[model samples]
Target: MAEPRFSRFAAIDWSGAQGHRHKGIAVAVCATGDAAPTLVAPPGASAWSRDDVLDWLLCQDTSTLIGLDLSPAFPFVDQDGYFPGAPDSPLDARALWKMVDDASAADPHLAVSSLLTDPEIRRHFRQHRDCGDLFPGGAGRMRVCEHGQRTMGLSPTSCFNLVGAAQVGKSSLTGMRVLHRLAGRLPVWPFDPLPPHGPAIVEIYTTIAARAAGIRKGLSKMRDAVSLDTALANLGSQPHRPLARYDDHATDAILTAAWLRANADRAELWRPQAMTPHIARTEGWTFGVS
Candidate 1:
């Protein structure tokens, strides 16, 4: 008998502060390389102590390809609110909710549908009701473990901005709508009804590409949207009238590019890897990407 081949897949819906984090992260680890992912936990209890969470994360099969909903980078701001750097925001749920509401009002087609109905969505906002925790202050506690680098959290505004634009939209939508939102644009709108920012078209593109790649189910209608032939043709490149800038859309495209690059057999090719750091181990954490 031969040993079975397997692949470990995981994703996190990151949150900080008391009660703001999801109940449990949506984790899917499988012993079969091609097996469909399964939910490891609900949206509650997802927040474990740092050590325990790290232990669980590191304990996963070494072949795992972990996708974190948290931003790995932040945005750069020069002037005119046109932040050019990576995106981030403070961990304040109220502020985030307000942003979501404002952004949703800017465009009707931009909200993630699941967020509108998901009970947990409101839970996230309600958790931060009274505390006066400020932004840029709690970043240190919301650190992201990227490429083995240990650092404080990226600016939540940057993450929201990057995702709200186009470069970092996939992660944001995933966090906002749960994985279901990434199912692709079709009968369902990708933006949350009360989205923190304007609709992210690039996220739409990424969702289409993800559906084409078979990462999501029940999106047969989106097949044509993410086809490689369509991507190569670049036809219908222009989407509906814009309420936001290209950078927002570009953020989604960039995330789609990452997903496609990571799983070319599934989606269309958009951008190539420009740079990837070799993560070094710190504090007993051996982190690095091949």
Candidate 2:
């Protein structure tokens, strides 16, 4: 296949903590070049709500490859079904996305707390407060791409493990609601076909971008300008301007956006060797993980 020619690249460091505004959420975007990425200020607030991200993303007008820093589905092939033994298990990722969205429809701000805490499904997750009764032990089950990520020496937490600092369970769960909404507007990679034009979303683990940028594991979180620019330079991107404050969330989005711009055209990234059709329909591959 030929290289994808996106006019722009965007990286969103998402959050799933329950609230109207999330300090963990960060969005950075850059054009189709080596220019530095800039963090987008939240609309009408100090922090961005989940709804704000949905609105902002839908409004973007460009052939952009949007990278969401969250998993869009749970472990499927590894366990045969997301909620194993449950007769109502989704047939595929789309059904899972709808199941998540439907569970949280009445909730405010696109939060998936209801779904996480639901009696019938809580047993499958290792939530912050308690490990579910049927929870798989030790970071829970891994997606196929996650196992590949492991071979590359990067750690990927399970969407079923919501505890600890590295936990992405909440974000992954909440992101499905966003993906469900963006289904038609923004076709998610692997699960949805690449459109002839317009924006599309893909799962991104910022750590992968950091690794490619020459930043070592466990030290990929840049909390200073010098460190951030150093990593950006490793990716052949221009140094970013000073931020209001130095933190991992903002730096992650900024650095990963530049990384996407630098690497988006690689044809091989769109086709990982281990990515079979079944895996694509279930636990979609991360964009840069091949």
Candidate 3:
């Protein structure tokens, strides 16, 4: 079979913080024949808003495959839904996305603080507190894919754990809002059907791309030009200039974009053994996690 090919590849390092602009958000893009990915900023803006990214995505002309570094859904299978015992929890991933979008309707830039403020929603998470006793038994809060990532040495965190620097719950929640808005415009992999031609977005773990680029674990970020170049080279690309910045968000976006460009044709990534129908509908799987 012919391999999948896209005209352009992009990756976004998303942030869930409340604001009109965020430094934590970074975007990188590379063309099919490009030697390296380049960090992209909004045309007239220094920083990118979640809305800015959505607008840019909608304006794209070519068939693009964008990788987003956030969890697409929470641990629904194991927990029986977002709100475990609550009778009104969402029925599926689409429903969950709508719930998050609806709850954060009043927040600027799609910030999910309002959803976190809810008594029921806040109870399942460990936010800004080290208390493990809040959750009953404090286990199974992570999804099956998260455990799979851990076994692969990626140090995946639970989407339900909203606290700590390593937690991705906030980004995921906010991303779901974006996903809900992009429902018909762009097809999300494994959840929505792949279109005949156009843009599609997929969930990505930047650490997985970093590992594929021969980066060692325990290193917090890649800032040096040599290391960045080497990592890009491993993914069939090289740095166009010195990527000496200390921002892990920028580096991750650059690396993952190149990785997507280099490896998007791999059949194994599209088909995972654990991506059952229920899991895809309730708890989405990471694109590269098999």
Candidate 4:
């Protein structure tokens, strides 16, 4: 068995919907043992704001490993660059995060509304009515790990396509801003080498965690205690306490946190076969994508 690398694992079900507080957002955390993950209530009886997540993350001890259900970057590999043909595009992930944060400096609640409005940046995405002229059709550009997800019978959304219910573009843009803020304070995997000890962040797809927990594909969303507990049990986690409401957002975070606890020390997960150094620096990968 792999030795434990982190004492606590946390998962954040992030949202990119235009709002200060989002009902779709949820957070769950668990420890090294088999105890079930606990849903963290948003402060003030309201839904969790993206900024609230950043604040909570900053407060977590160094022993925690945070996983977020948001893409840290747009595709760069297929097109040979993040913004093909666009001059002076960010050279690396940190620069991309800086550009995103700078573009939305005026946006409140850690949102990146202003970033989407930027003409230069807007040319790469497919927003509501306007399909970017540069937008590559037929599923858009995909990162290496995204392709792996498809190979494993999981469909991963391209961050460049901003339409549809599963649009990851907004979430990614907004999360990039938070990532920029956390740059010096926390080390995001691949962007910075995984430190020997300290709090670190990794991009996580809740579906990946769900599938690993033995939840069938396309049916990973748990809407009740029984389904949630069954998935938890598959990961050697104890049964979760009864929740007043069992929605996808809550269940996803809870299950992913437990999954993170179980898999953090896996050697192959940290070092994927297809991930080259250039890919890691250009497009950070999703955890468990190997």
Q: RMSD for all candidates, in order, please.
A: 16.9, 1.6, 2.0, 1.3
Report the candidate with higher lDDT, 1 versus 4. 4
Clashing pairs in 2: none
Of 1 and 2, the candidate ranking higher by TM-score: 2
Q: What is the lDDT of residue 66 in candidate 1?
A: 45
As a whole number from 0 to 100, the lDDT of residue 6 in candidate 1 is 16
The residue-by-residue lDDT of candidate 4 on 38-106, one tens digit each, is 989998867999988999888876688999999998788887888877778888888999988987899
Candidate 2 vs candidate 3: the lDDT winner is 2
**TM-score (C-alpha) between model 1 and the true structure:** 0.31
Point out the higher-scoring one by TM-score: 3 or 4: 4
Which one is best on lDDT?
4
Question: How high a TM-score does candidate 3 get?
Answer: 0.93
Whole-model lDDT, model 4? 0.89
Candidate models: Cα lDDT each: 0.29, 0.88, 0.83, 0.89
Candidate 1 lDDT over 102-174, as tens digits, reads: 4344322333333323343322221223211222322212112322132211122323222122233334433
TM-scores, one per candidate: 0.31, 0.96, 0.93, 0.97
lDDT of 2 by residue, 1-290 (tens): 76457988899999988878988999999986678999899998999899999999999878998999999888899879999976698989999999999988888888887787688798888876788888979878999999999999988988889888889988898899998898777778989877778888888999988888899867888999999999999999989989998888999999999988888878788889999999999999998878
